[model samples]
Target: MTNSKKFALVTGSSNGIGRAIAENCAARGFNVLLVALPEPKLEEVTNALAAKYPNQEFHCLGVNLMDAGAPQEVFQWCQKNNFVVDILANNAGLGNSGDFLSKKAEFYFGQMQLNMVAMVMLTHHFLPEMQKLDKAYILNVASMASYYDIPFKGIYAASKKFVSSFSHSLRYELKDSNVFVSILCPAAVLTNPEVIKRDANMGFVSKITRQTAEQVAEYALSRMFNRKPVSIPGVFPKFYRTLGRVIPHRMQLRMLANAFIKQSRE
Candidate 1:
C-alpha cells in the first residue's frame, strides 16, 4: 500500500526552493501536491510541472498556511483527494531584512507564525501518516541564520533557530521509525531577481556561498533520502557553520554586527 502511494506534499511550492523540490519529486515519479497562497504563481507552477511530467500526477492547493486552521484544511483536502502523502516538505517561511524596530509587532509576529508555528502544525498533522509508510521522509527548510543570533534580522534568525532545533529533536525522536527527517540550512539561494540583488549587496561571502534553487533542492533531497539529520548546502556554508561554533560568542556577535554594517553600506 505504501509503495503504491508515493505522494509528496510540499508547502510553498509556488517558487524558490519549494518549486525546485516539487519539480524534483515529480521527476522522481512521485505524485506532488503543491501548497501555497492563492496566487497566480501556484497555478503557474502546477501547470508547468503537469506539462513537464505528464505521467506523474500534479495537484495544487492555494491556501494561506499562516491561518491557524490551514494545517487541518490541508489534511482534509488530502483525505478528500485520496492522496496518501509519503513525503512532507515543509518549505514555507518568511523573514524581514531590516532592523527589528523598523516593523510593527504584527509584522514580526506574523513572520513567526508563518516560519515556525505553521511549520510545526504541518509536521504535527503529517508525521503520523508518514510513519505508516514503509519508507517516508520529512524535509524542513531552515536558513543559515538558524546558526546565529543576528541583529537586524533578530526575529527571523530566532524563528529559523527554532526550526533547526525542532528538526534535530524530531529526527532523534523518530529515529526508530521508517520516516527519515532532515533539515536543510542553505545560505543566499538565488531564487529570484530580488534575492539576487540582495545577495549581491551582501558582499563576497554571500556571493560565494550563494546557490541556485535547483542546486539546493537536489543536494538537500539526496542527503535527506540518505537519512542525514542535517544538510548545509554549500561548502562555504558548512565550513562557516563549523567555524562559528569554535569562535568566541562575543567575537561572533561583533563580527556579525560588522558584517551587517558592511551590507548596509552596500
Candidate 2:
C-alpha cells in the first residue's frame, strides 16, 4: 500500500448506487478506484467522474467479480498501482423477482456466486490491509429485503440476509482494529429503468419506502463513516425493517406471498 493519498475502492461502480457512492467519496477528497465489468459503461463512468473531479485521482478497474479470481486480481492491481485503499465498498449485487423453482439451477447458483461469494472474497482480500491503517471503512450493501423472506424473491432475500448477518458479526470481530465495518440495507433504489417502472407501479409502498440511487449513496457513505452498524436509507425503510422484526414469521411469509404473488399475476 502506498503512503500517499487514500483511495476508496468501490465495486459495481459503473452505474446506480455504486457510481453515486464512488463520486461521493471522490468529492470528499479521496482518490477513487472504480471496479466494474469490462464494458463501455465502466469507461463512460470513469471518464465522466475524472472530468468532474479533476483534482482527485480516478483509477478504473474492469473486471468481472463473478469470476472467482477477480478479487485477488483487483488487490494485486491496486498494489501494483501503489494505490493504498482507505475504504472498501462491497456494493456489487443482483436481485431478481420470480418463483425460485421456475428458474434453472445454474441461474440460482450464479446469483449465489455473484451476490454472496464475490462480496465475501472482496472483503477478505482488502480487510487485512485496511486493518493496518489508522482508520478505514468497509461498507457492505445488503437490502431491505434482508429483514423478510419474500416468496417470489426468495434467493435474493436470503443472500442479502447472509450479507447483513455477516457484516454485523464482522464488525464486532474487527472492533479492536482500525477497520470499521457497516452495512447498508436500502429498500427500493430507483437504479435502472426496470426498477423505475416497477417503483411507479407498486403504488403507495414504493413511494413511501423507495429512494433514488443518489439519495441512498449519499446516506450510506455518511452512515458508514460514522461507523453505524446498519443503515436503512429512507425513513419508511427504517420503519418497515423495524416493523418486520416483531411480526410473526408465518404472518410475514403470508404477507409477502399475498403482495409479490399478486404482483407476479398482474
Candidate 3:
C-alpha cells in the first residue's frame, strides 16, 4: 500500500517563492521533493532544509526543466525512490519582459516552452494519480498579467493566461475526482532579487503593496487544500483581476502600453 502521508513536490524551490513553498511544506509535516536546477543555491537550500528539518524527509533533485525530457525524469525519479506526492507545486518559470516584435520568435516560443509546455507535461505526469487520491492538490503560480493583455510583458502574460485557463479546465475535468487544484495569481512582489534591481520607472518597485513570498505561499496553499479554484495571493492583484474584467479592452491595452513604455524609457 502507498504511504498516505502527504508528500509535496515543489519545482524551482532553490529560491524566491519556490524556496518559501518548499520550506512551508516541510513545516507542515509534508515530506518534500525539491526540484531545481543544479547550482550553488540549490545545494545551499537543500543543505539548509535538511539541517533545519531533520525529522522530515527531504530529497533535492536538480534538473533543468527547460530540457524537453525533464518532466518525465521527475516522474521516473519518484517511481524509483518510492515517493508519492500529495501536492505538485509548479513554480518554475521565466519572465518575458520588453518588446514583442523586437524579440525573436524563438524567445517568445521558448518562454512558452518553459512556462506552458513544461507545466502541462509535469501536470500530466502526476495528475492521474492525484485524481485517484482522496486528498491531493496542484498549485500553479500565475501572475497578475494572466488576467489582462499586458503591453511590454506580452508573451509572459500570454503564457500565464494559458496557465490560468489550463488550470480552470483541469479543475472542471477532475471535478468528479477528489484532488483539488488552485492557480495562484499574484502582483508585483518586491523580493530581495527583484527589489535591488532598479525598475526603470518604479524605482525599486515601491508601487507594490503585497505579502512577502513566504506569506503568499502559506496563504495560497491553505486555500489550495481547501479546494479553491483560484487564489489571488494579494488584495491588489485580485483588484487588478477584477479591474481587467470591467475595463474596456482598448483602453486597458493603451494604459498598459503607456505605463510600461514610460517605465522602459526611465
Summed over model 1, clashes come to 0
TM-score of each: 0.95, 0.95, 0.92
| lDDT of candidates 1 onward, in order | 0.87, 0.87, 0.81
Higher-ranked by lDDT: 2 or 3: 2
lDDT of 1 at 75: 88
Task: Summarize candidate 3's per-residue lDDT along 1-266 as a digit string, tens digits.
Answer: 35544579999899888899999998888889889888788878978888999988888889988788999999888877778888999988877556767678977776787789889999999987777777888999887778888888788889999999999998888888877778988666555443334233544333654568888888888888888888787666666778889999999999888767654443
RMSD of each: 1.9, 1.5, 2.2
Q: Give the range where candidate 2 is weakest over 10 consecutive residues by summed lDDT.
A: 257-266
In model 1, state the lDDT of residue 67: 87
Span of 10 residues, lowest total lDDT, candidate 1:
257-266
Encode model 2's per-residue lDDT on 68-137: one tens digit a residue.
8898999999888788888999998877776777778878887888889998998898887788889999
**Candidate 1, residue 152: lDDT:** 69
Residue-level error in angstroms, candidate 1, position 173: 1.0
Model 3, clash count?
Answer: 0
Candidate 3 global lDDT: 0.81
lDDT of 1: 0.87
Please give, for residues 43-99, the per-residue lDDT of candidate 1 as tens digits: 999999999989888899999988889989998898777788889999998866666
